[model samples]
Target: MTPETVIGFARSAIEITLLLSLPMLAVSLVVGVVLSVLQAATQIQEMTLTFVPKLVAMFIAIILAFPWLMDKMVGFTRDILLNLPKYIQ
Candidate 1:
């Protein structure tokens, strides 16, 4: 593995990681923001108010996105495995 090959592997890993996490992260962010706004409006400043909803939303997001996530992960793994011989050189 040359430096460029190593870098390429690192970049692909990072990209796949970010892509896989994006759905849950986005869901959590949107839920948190909406909860924050609602809290502000109702003047209910409970610190724990946002946790449950965000957790649920993120869980739903992961559930809904699981197939797609698995597909991406499998493809990345396949590609990496397929390229292993080339990388070994």
Candidate 2:
């Protein structure tokens, strides 16, 4: 493959990675911020208070988004596999 093709594939791989990670990351971020605010307000600064909720929220988010995430991953893998010959040439 040409340098340009290699770069394009690398760029696409990065983009796909970022796209797949954004939802869970965003959910975690929001949950963390909200938990922070709650801790600040209530003066309940327990470590588990923060850890448990964020973990649960992230777990729920992953469960809810599993289908879409799987679809994107499968599609990307299928595209790469199907086009393997083109890349090999």
Candidate 3:
């Protein structure tokens, strides 16, 4: 493949990765911020306090978003597979 094609593929891969990860990351970030605020307000300050909630929230988010995530990944894989001949040429 040409340099432009290579770069385009790289960019697409990175974009897909970010798109797939953003939801979970955003959820975790929001949960962490909220937990921090609660801890501050309640003066709990327990190190493990945030872990369970964040884990649970992330797990829930993943479960909720699994279908969409799978669709995106499958589509990406299909596109790459279908375009394999073009890359080979």
Candidate 4:
């Protein structure tokens, strides 16, 4: 571990984290925005009205996206494991 090698590993870890998280974050964001718009249009300011739809949508998205998420995680893990010797120094 030279500094550049450490930095590269850190960058890869960050990128993998972001890639893994993006699906859920994006789904939540889009669902929240859409629900907020609908709530505004209906003037249903119940406050708690927002939670159910977003939660359900995110849950459904996660369920549907689970395989792809798993594959990404597995690939990242494989890469890290394969590169262990490089980090060992």
Pairs that clash in candidate 3:
none
Candidate number with the higher TM-score (1 or 2): 1
What is the Å distance of residue 39 in model 4 from its true position? 1.3
lDDT of each: 0.93, 0.94, 0.96, 0.88
lDDT of 3 by residue, 1-89 (tens): 99999999999999999999998999999999999999999999897899999999999999999999999999999999999999989
Task: Kindly list the per-residue Cα lDDT of model 2 for residues 1-89, writing each as its tens digit.
Answer: 98988999999999999999998899989999999999999998899998988899999999999999999999999999998999999
Where is model 2 poorest over a 10-residue stretch in terms of lDDT?
Answer: 50-59
30, model 2: CA deviation in Å? 0.9
Model 1 poorest ten-residue lDDT run = 46-55
lDDT for model 2: 0.94
Off by over 4 Å in 2: none
The CA lDDT at 63 in model 3 is: 98
After superposition, the stretches of candidate 3 with alpha carbons farther than 4 Å from their true spots are none
Q: Against the true structure, what is every candidate's RMSD?
A: 0.6, 0.8, 0.6, 1.1
Q: TM-scores of the models, in the given order?
A: 0.97, 0.95, 0.97, 0.90
The sequence of per-residue lDDT tens digits that candidate 4 reaches over residues 5-86 is 8899899989989988888889989988988899889988876778887788888988988999999989989998998997
